[model samples]
Target: MKFFNKTGKLAIGSRLRMLTEKITEDAANIYKLYDIELQPKWFPVFYVLSQGEAKIVTDIAKEIGHSHPSVSKIVSEMAKQGLITEKKDKADGRRNMVTLSPKGKMIAEKIKDQYADVNAAIEQLTAQTENDLWKAIEEWEFLLEQKSLLTRVGEQRKNREGSYVQIIDYIPTHREAFKNLNEQWISQWFKMEEADYKALDNPQGYILDKGGYILVALYNNQPVGVCALIKMNDPVYDYELAKMAVSPTAQGKSIGWLLGNAIIEKARSLGAGKIYLESNTILKPAVNLYHKLGFQKVGGRPSPYERSNIQMELIIKSSPFQKTAE
Candidate 1:
C-alpha cells in the first residue's frame, strides 16, 4: 500500500500526494481517539477561521490554497454541523463572512493537545529520512517560485517540437528579443558585465555600425534565437562570434546550428579573414558546437570577460556553394 518505495524517485508528485493522504488519515484517527468529531478535509478552512476573525469564502480559499467552490462546499457542511456561522460582511452586504461558532471553539480547545501530538508525530517522521523533508520542500518551493513548474514543462514541450524556424538577418525591430535572449543565457552562465551590457543594449552602436553582422532565428515570426559577429580590433581575426543564444523553449532543435551557419556564411560573404570566439569551458554544448564547426583552440589573448576559459578560431575553407579544384 506504500507508494513512496514502490514508485521510486521520478514519481515525486505522486509520492507527495500519497504522503499527504496518509498524514490526513493519521490526523483523522487522532481526532477519533480524542473523541472529537472532525474530518481532515475541513481542517484548513476551519483553522483559518478559528483565529477569532470573520473572513469571506474567497479570502479563506486564497489563504488555504483551495478553490472558491471547494471552500464554499466545506463552509456549507460546517454550517450544517453547527461548527461555524456565516453572515454578510458589514463592509460589503453581498459578501458573506464566516467565523467559528461557540461550539466549534469549544471543540478546538478540547483537541488542541491532540493536534500538537499529531504535528510532533509528523516531525518525527522527517527524522526517518536521510534529508529533512521540510528543508527540501522549502528549497523546491523557492525554485518553483523562480520559474514555475508549468513554464518549465511548456518549454520542454516546445523544444521537442520546433518545426518552423526561419533564420534571418537582424532588423531594427528585433532589438529587444536579441537583448533578452542573450541576457537570459549570460545571466544563467555568468554575470552580465559592463561590456556585455554595452554590446547588447546598443547593438547598432557596438555591432552593425562597425561592419559586424547579426543573425536571428524566428519561430512563428518571433525571434527565438540570436547570434552576432562583431568586427575585432585586431588585424589577425576579422570577427568575433559573440552573443549567441537560443530561447530555452526553442533549444534542442538545431537552432544553434542554424544561427551559427547563418552568421558564419555571412562572414564568408563579407570576405572575412578569420572568425574567432571566446567562451567558458563550463558551457560544454556551445564549446562542442564550435569544435564541430571546425573551430580550433588557440592561444589566449587578454579577454575583457572573467568568464573566458576557452578561445577558438574558425578558418572557413570556402563558401558552401563554391566547389574546389581536384
Candidate 2:
C-alpha cells in the first residue's frame, strides 16, 4: 500500500478535512453556476446582514458563533467591495453599525431563488445519512459552548465519578499498588519472573533509591497504573523504561499514557538520555503507545524477562501539549 492510503481512511481529522474540501468545492461550483460573483466565505455575513436593518460587529459575531475579530475582518472585506457600509450608531456613539449596501441588496434579490435551490440540495444530500450530521453538530457545539470537551470530562469526573486520576511519585504506601498491578498482568500472560518479584518486593530500594523513579496513577486514592524509570551508566545516563502496567479494571481511561509520559518526563527531570523498554508483540497497545511517544525499535537488548521480544527507545525532548489537552 502507498504511504498516504495505508491507514485505510481511518484518519478522522484528515477524512473530515477531505469532506469539508468537497463541500466547499460544491458550494463554489453552485455559486459559479448561478453566476453569483461571491465567495462562500462571504455568504454567512451577507445573508445575516440582509435579514436586519443594521447590526454591530459584536451582534453579527454572536449570531454566527464566530470571533469578533473574525467577523470584523470579514466586515472589512465586505466594506472594501462596497457590499456593506459602516457608520456610527445613532443610539450609541461608541458603536459602529454595519448595513448592506444597495448593490448588495440587488445581488441578494437576484440570487434568492438560486440560494433556495442550493439549500434544498444540501438538505437532500444530508438527509441520506442515518444520523443527521447538522443536528449532531448543533448539539456538539452547544455542549462545547457550555464547557470545553476536556472541561466537561473533568466536571463529569468530579461530579459523577467522584474522583480523578492523579500521577504521583512512588511512596511507601504505593508498594502494594505497584506490585499487584505489575504482578497481575505478568502472571496472567507470562508467569511472574524473579526480577519482577525482586522489584515488586522492594520497589523503593530496588527502583526509587537506585537513582530510578516510579510514577503511579491513582484514581479515588487507589493505584490504577504504575511505571518506573531505571537509571543505568552515568554521565550519559541511559534509562531502562520498565515494569509499566495499568490495572485491568482501569484499563481504558488513558491512565497508561499518563504513566508512560510521566515516566518520560521523569527521565527528563533527571537529565537522562535514551530511555528504552523491552516488550512482547502480544501487547499491541503498549507497543503502539511507545511508537506514539517517539520510541523507535532496536532489536535484541537482552531483556531480563522471558516474555521480552520487542525493544524500543525514546530520546527525550520538550513536551508540547495539544490545545484542547492543555
Best by TM-score: 1
- Which residue pairs collide, candidate 2? none
Model 1 shows how many backbone clashes? Answer: 0
lDDT of each: 0.88, 0.83
Q: Return the TM-score for each candidate structure.
A: 0.52, 0.50
Error of 2 at 285 (Å): 1.2
Question: Candidate 2 at 45: error in angstroms?
Answer: 38
TM-score of 1: 0.52
Pick out the ten consecutive residues of candidate 1 with the lowest summed lDDT.
Answer: 317-326
lDDT of model number 1: 0.88
Q: Report the number of the highest-lDDT candidate.
A: 1
